[model samples]
Target: MPSLPTIVLVDDAAEVRSLVRLQLRLAGLGEVVGEGADGRDAVVLAAQWSPDVMLLDVSMPDLDGLGALPQVLEASPRTRVVMYSGFTDPALAEEAVRRGAVSFVQKSTDLDALVGEVRRLLPGEQPAAAPDAVPGAEDHDPRAAARELEQHVERFAGVFDDAAIGMATLTLQGRLVRANSALARVLGRESADVVGNHYPEVVRSGGDADGRLTAALERATRGDDDVVEVEHRYRGSHLRTTFSPVRDQRGRPLYVFAQCQDVTRQRQAEDQLRQAERRFRLLVEAVEDYAIFMLDPTGHIASWNSGAQRSKGWTAEEIVGQHFRVFYPVEVARSGHPEHELMLALRDGSYHEEGWRVRRDGSRFWAHVTITAVHDEEGHHIGFAKVTRDNSERHRLLEEQERYARALAEANERLERANHQLAAAAEDQAQFLAVTAHELRTPVSVLSMSGRTLGEHWRELDESERDEILEGMETSSARLQRLLGDLLTTSRIQASTLDLRLEDVELAAALAPTVDELRRVHVGAELRLEVEAGTRVRADPGRLAQVIENLVANAVKHGAPPITIRALAVEHSVEIEVRDAGEGVPVELLPRLFERFTSRGAGGTGLGLHIVRELSRAQGGDAWYDPVRTAFVVRLPASGPP
Candidate 1:
């Protein structure tokens, strides 16, 4: 006899390697020299053993068979490699052939054929036919046919038991005829327990009696070409099932082939994604301060939000589908600044600048604009997301601050010269102290009168009268407290002692109590609050409350009734606005609204707005005025959850 060819087997599944080894030995076709469980080990074994032939599985963990093919051959140049796998694809076979694999065989091929192929590739091995046997003898022999069937059944059994995915075969009556270990584990039962049980009945007992599986089985068994698939929930587990019919020669169904996968985690992830999308949509729609919108590839407005309507003064129905350049001032639009911004965003992925934009009424306001490019998975530019905020008030305040700095420098220089005239300066300072004292005496006098009235006629006064007296006293007390706070805050500013204890605070929780207190203090003014829940800010809660109280109190004292307090969450910040239903402040006073002692009405020390702005700036935020709405708006750093 010719020398037996030595072979090595490589497969991820130990059972598969063992079966192939046993079949080769039983057929007396070759001698097994070594075995490996993955492609990396196969390369080392092939080089060590120097086998005549190597049977390598195509799909293995770490490095696949194709990836290892060139390396294996380079290591053992004399070894002829045969790529084998349960999955047969022409593309993979072609790739294997190109990579120096002598042949490709499906694991489902008959054992006799597989042995013959391996023998033919081995050195000095030639298959011979006996003189008594005619051509195609096995095709006509009953024994040969029976043996072939047995071998096929064995191969199938090996593959089914070792499959990584859950698989089963059911009879026409819906009874389980066979099940793999994977399927048994998915159902949390033994293979024997699942073999004879009805599949639909088992599913029903598992608390997922949706009848979908049964319907799928019925449809598949009716000689339909469509594969049936459905997601089923059973006993807190999510199963994705697919059903296909196994047909006989005449296209009549014989069995139902089914595959089940546990998709519970996948379903949960999808639900979370949907909920996040919903929250994002609500956040986009709820914003009313900044213009947040989308643009197409060519810079046309694709979508708009309520904030876009309020800021740009163009409703969605009118603005959408129009060029974003419409919002730019006439001169800026003519200069192609909008198009230039889009080009910059496309090139660098984002662009931001402060420029002039036009509202619908033809008025121009300074705006801070940002444009960001949006892309798909392949990095193809799809569109752009644009955000614009009315920064005119901020620009004005910056100019004022520069002027104030210059004036302070001049004053310091003058004081150096005025040290010689200290007596004259002392008189002016004394007069200033007297004016401050007079401002304090007003609220104190009101509080004393209200307290005396409530104490002297507690029972004699009617309920409405008593309530009015109590509200007046509370208002006066709040007034005094505000004055003292302002004085302290001013002193701290001069001494640079103002500090903040920044923390994550829910805007609604912080503002609700302030609104309630405002209603009690201003009983005659109708106070309405509209605030979004779960809006958080990074700021000191006590200082934030004081800012809100001062704004609302100013509305009550200067503006008319029906004052509205609105709070909205924007990108990177939270905005709170206090609006009243009255004619707005004089345009002349708007520029100096936040100046110290700048009051348009009586009973104010002109420090309320000034203190509000100072406190906001210390917390990495700022305060501004919306002259159109007569609203004082405060923007603060948002403390969104990490």
Candidate 2:
């Protein structure tokens, strides 16, 4: 159920909701994750699940759909709202779309058409319901099939006058003998004005299209088995019209029934999706640094990019249909590690590691692999995007370094820095390798070189030179400590194990320790903290300080000093703003600035801002990067007197 496209059904009438649910289930259109009786419930359900489509009733008690339209969208921005009503007024339909609904659907529409409208808003192919009963020739009485067809048509006719889609009966000569009010509204005319016109004339297509439709109508009269699908333009609406002919037991031609649905918006959406898919396909095929491919939900290979072909030594044609487990070593496959990786990706959004992977030629290479779960806009977990880069050379060098460090461990106290850095990897080495390999490597190199320099040339170095090297060592050590703290906190947060003891905390005092530490470490940078008296917040004191320190460190690392930290009381909350006078975060990275492993192309573990946000939220607050002000802001529920 979690892998299904979800929908929220909202209506004041329980009967309407129940019937729609039945239709949706019968069509396998989507899962109704939530149901609501009024406009306020619509907003709450939208916020809770962020379903793909919302069927909103136009009239409800307390707050109507029109009033809830903006709120529901604000709560869940991806939800496509469809206004449902019993009225067929064009003005109301126009207003609903004007207020952000994707479409307006009349409640009187046949349930099948309503199902289609909902299906149109969601992306992907839908499963169609099989016909419940169809008379066979063996069992057919002369009137049996005809009676069955008429019974279906009779049911359709009951809703013909009020259905949202355009329905018409045309003569064998392609003339419209009848038109419904909905079709008339689409044509900007009354039903009386639209009827009795040539279908081609009413549609207003060019000569070529008219001739094609006329021929199609002539063919449609010959058999009921063929369906002629055509697009017709009237006013500004693009109607997707389908002509189905009715026949008797002897197969004599009968009137052609046409169903026309406005498909202008759907066509535009499909065009945009095609363009995006083309661009993405081009991008994927052009990447050659790693093997990037997609696996189906059940782990069968779905797509193979050029990078996959180059690195894995198999062309797309040879590899696209194989199971993704083929890339794993035989022992690993037998151990169920491939399935485990996929399970981890689905459960945690991604799985990353360094391990051996088999090539098509049966050779093994150490690979750094990341398998990320891909979800559609409807929040359905569709597949996994796996990226694998050959890291054999790096792994070999790391092994050599470890061996050399182990050999020299007892020789000199001066080699202590390298040993300490190596010891840092004794725990959670896989995690450290995945997240901060580059970051940790640089700092380790600095400390190693500084130790070797002093050890090899103690007599040649003067007092000032020795002090500068020692200061560099101090800075690198502090950096490693901070990165480790961030890693631990991030792990706790991601595992949902972080404990917060929240209370009234004075803003100025909580920040004093962090400020002193930064000032002492960065003597050349100016750091200012400003807060009005009596400013306080309801937050965990330790986590609050950690959040503040991380933001200041970001400013110090990524922006130019002087940096300022200001806490201001506003209404029932207190906002702590940390700002620097440097250029703000780039527009592209701003949207994902707080995401894990998101970097600004600067140095440090990418977990700082992510941890800051998580810690703030854990204590009933939130954090954001304000690109316009070049500041990182944290807002928390306020406490104490104003």
Candidate 3:
């Protein structure tokens, strides 16, 4: 018992393959070795199985049986190709035989009667290239067969001459013996001009084509290589040329047969695609405000862009290959937040968020981040594409705005309460105007008179007289400046625009200047300070000074002196009192004294006491008149030096 002849069946229809496979097996003529659905698989099957016989369909997707026939023969030279199809046209059989099939069998043919035919066409020694004869040439007379062979050779020669691709035959010594019109056109010359020139020189229009190609051609001519292919420039067009050596029966190399194709369009298209990809990559890498990059599967950083380097302070060389967790806070990474983001992206296709992200310098930024799961054509998750934008400035601005809003609301609440309490006294604002004019008049008159006296008396007065006049002017100027400052502060306090820098302010140290200034201005009055040692309050120093100044002015303008400034350190707060030895504010006026425009005497603008109360409250404290002690008191939150 001999081994069964092996067979491969190919068809677009599965039923046809099954029917043929079963019939061949039932006939006991061969064993079914492989199956294919189309011409692409037919070539692969030929290469893999090298079956005794291959039954190939005439038509299939991607490549047809007729198209795959030569490739099949090239892949498995010893195996026989039997063209199989539903159509019974005799011309199909003739065409198949011309392209190197051993036989053509219609599907309608009875398998019982075809076993002997299949056996006759099994594996056998054959030429490596396609056969030259048409089907049925063996059945004709010798002269008729000779004529048929001549016609076949003539038809092949015509195909060679008129083919779209360039074809030429060259002597093994490298001379072009013949070239098709297509070859001549590819070389940018007449057919006659291209036919006799050395192939490489003809390709470049005169110069030697390239050293590597010359070597390849030499190797092909020497039979050292079975096939040689190269891509090179020719006549300003890109081309790919293949060289194959024709050999005699004893395996001696003859002339070299070559095929050339004008791949200029394809090459140009490929170059354009590569350039577009390069430009896109550069664009992604150059962006600086947004960090755009890629991560591999399992969350390792695969690419880093310029924005990532700029914002996160990590160069691509340092960050790439590290895990994406490197961009997250240590606690966040430990909590598996980065991995959670990856998982969420995988589940949802994309994840977007705005939150804090860590930087290389240990600083943090408010980052708007997006992570998108990336997939290949087959839809397998490969990695993630991440984009992060630094939004720290915007975040900070939003917070500051919220703080201002809260401050405004608090100011409005306090203003509302004060308006309710002072509703009956709204008519008193008219008196406030009168008080401002009268207070403003005193300083303006003193300045005008002092200037006149100084101008006239400079030559007439002695040194003591001149000094006393200038002192009067300086005191009036200081008083005028303090009044203007009070006015501006009132405007800012009402506008809610006043800003403060709070710190541990020592009451004694901070008040020394204001007390000395008062001593100079009120030269005959006794002004004293009693500050407990190391006493401090939590307040803005400049604002605290304003509060003290207003209280002192209130005592001097309304109550009488000697004025006493005292600081007392309490358990959770500190107290500062401005007192005068004169009779205290009347009981009836005391209730309305802290109101913005309530007046005690004609000498004051009535804003000093209100400002004192408001400024103290703004620094987390309050002010009031302690009638029993005959003192105007400010109580502020206590503090210790840091």
Error of 3 at 483 (Å): 2.3
lDDT per residue for candidate 2 within 278-372, as digits (tens), equals 99767745768678888999999999877788788999889887888899999999999999999999999999888889999999998988899
Residue 504, candidate 2: Cα error in Å is 1.2
Error (Å) of candidate 1 at residue 567 is 3.1
- Cα lDDT for residue 589, candidate 3: 78
lDDT of 1: 0.73
The better-scoring model by TM-score among 2 and 3 is 2
> What is the Å distance of residue 169 in model 1 from its true position?
99
Report the C-alpha lDDT of model 3 over 505-580, residue by residue, as the tens digit: 8778888998898777666667889897688899999988888777776676666778899988767998898899
Pairs in steric clash, model 3: none
Instruction: After the best TM-score superposition of candidate 1, give how far the Cα of residue 60 lies from its true spot, in angstroms.
Output: 99
Clash tally, candidates in order: 0, 0, 0
TM-score of each: 0.32, 0.34, 0.33
| Cα error, candidate 3, residue 34 (Å) | 99
